[model samples]
Target: MQGQNGRGTDMPPAVSVRLEVIKRRSDFLKAARAQRRGMPGFLLQARRRASDEPDPSAIRVGFTCSRKVGNAVTRNRAKRRLRALAREILPQLGRPGWDYVLVGRPGATVTRDFAAMREDLIRALRRIHESPQ
Candidate 1:
């Protein structure tokens, strides 16, 4: 049997971990001051939520692309790519009660190979976790 896009109907859909999007400007600022891991394709900023914060069980994430990345279309495309990368990687590697921000690089994020970007994420996460908090 064929599924929606011609894939086999028997194949189960991808299971992604629950995540909350960070919307407040303050939250992004907080992450900006917290731990950061720089990769070739993106910069990851992560911060552990304080005990006083709400949604202690939620994993929060945000995406941003500056004008330096390019025009509206280019920035949007970069954010989209960052979102896709986060969706695929964060579920398994992300820590609960933490916020993550993926900052798009000017030339790398939009042009880097996806597999290379994935590798970059893996390494970045490892470094972030290994560093002193």
Candidate 2:
């Protein structure tokens, strides 16, 4: 059967498969001060948005790679990798009302196996959710 987005799928309708992109520097900084889980390929930072905040029912995400990671080309490449991974994983595992930031690490993010990076994100999400606020 075809889903709303025009892809064939067997998944239930009760599950949300959409993620909102975070574009503001302030939002990224806010999540940065919340919680972080480090993996070899990347770092995951997540924070719960206030109940009164807009679009509290959507999962928001931001991606970034610092100059330390490399020059413009490398940093953009790393961010592209991160964006792809987030698109694949976040819709399924991400919690609503939360903002997540994925920071790419030099060398590792560009070269590590994709499967490992997926696992890292999953594990990081689990840890972040289970930790006390």
The candidate that wins on lDDT is 2
List lDDT for all candidates, in order.
0.86, 0.88
Report the error of model 1 at residue 39, Å: 0.7
lDDT per residue as tens, model 2, 61-113: 99999988999999999999999988877887788999999999989988899
Residues 1-133 of candidate 1: C-alpha lDDT, one tens digit per residue = 5655343332235456787899999999999999998888999999999989997878899999999999999999999999888887777678888899999999899999987887788678778888888
| Cα error, candidate 1, residue 103 (Å) | 0.3
Q: Candidate 1, which ten residues in sequence have the lowest lDDT sum? A: 5-14
What candidate 1 gets wrong by more than 4 Å, as runs, is: 1-16
TM-score of structure candidate 1: 0.87
Candidate 2 clash pair list: none
